[model samples]
Target: MTTYLPKDVTDGLHAARKQDMARKSRLRVEADGRSFAVLRRWQGGFAVDASVVPPLRGLVDLFEGSSPIASCLIIAAEAEDGEMHYEFKRATAMRHSAPLDFQKDDDAPVALIGQ
Candidate 1:
């Protein structure tokens, strides 16, 4: 005989799976001093747990652990399946400075073998 799980049980399982994936992801979102785990991300948009924060809009920052990844303008937000998906009006990547070794002082004189 074939058997199927109840709707609530299946929903719970799906929610658990989403939570697990978010926990494992290094990506996170920050807005108004609040941080939320990213459920999914792409070039145009991202998703976060709806239970954590209220509906998001306007500017928000994306981060990979402690590093800033991008500045996104959330033009739209939709909540579904316990997750809030945001569509960005614009997503600008953060610029990082070069390593100390890679940077050179142009005014500094070069060393010579014999002077």
Candidate 2:
């Protein structure tokens, strides 16, 4: 885990808690959770965090808009194996069918593709 001073930790938590749901970290919103930037927005349904931006922006078309955890590549869930696993809904911009729920699915994705 990353260690920080009491003030730093407190400030970080406060900032994270203030993030928006629109996936725009740079912009402030009234959402209840942290919103990563928009990596890309799909046609049918789905969106993901902008973590893979810059390096992968050219490869995947990260658009604007919010996609649910079920559709975006934001979080990863692991079963009872003590091993890391990604959510079934987790997929690249091209493979999403819906949006992932930000409330229930807050974990980030374990892996990125086409980088």
Candidate 3:
């Protein structure tokens, strides 16, 4: 499903782009090991315009091509303009190459200790 991001987030993304030195990279999203496209991306979060099989609730990985960039939590999901929109928060690197699983289970969700 398609998601719409907040104005401030979009504005920041655009502002970053206007700066010449910032790394301009679009991310590919993965939910529970399944690859998905990041239709829109920013520093804070991104959106995927496809159905989240069984629905996503926890971690979502952001990749730059094959390299893992960040792992975010799927904080909220809702219908926007006849599509499911997933909202994520800034990711935490729990461990290198961790599966970035989104399952809410006994295991603690990956988080960055000491901001």
Tell me the spans in candidate 3 whose CA falls farther than 4 Å from its real position.
Answer: 1-26, 51-54, 93-115
Kindly indicate the candidate among 1 and 2 with the higher lDDT: 1
* Over 4 Å off, model 1: 1-3, 98-115
lDDT of 1 by residue, 1-115 (tens): 7689999999999988987988899999898999888989887798887777678889999999999999988965678888888898988889897547666888877886776
lDDT digits (tens) for residues 2-102 of candidate 3: 69999999868755543322234355667777876565565555554434334567888778778777778876556553234666665775456557557
Ranking under TM-score, best-scoring first?
A: 1, 3, 2
Model 3, position 70: C-alpha lDDT score? 74
Per-model TM against the reference: 0.78, 0.19, 0.47
- Top model number, lDDT: 1
lDDT of 2 by residue, 1-115 (tens): 9665698788676455434433343221112233335322344322333232221211122233443332233333332212222232434534455666655645867678885
Off by over 4 Å in 2: 1-5, 9-18, 21-36, 39-57, 66-115
lDDT of each: 0.86, 0.35, 0.61
What C-alpha root-mean-square deviation, in Å, does candidate 1 show against the real structure?
A: 4.7
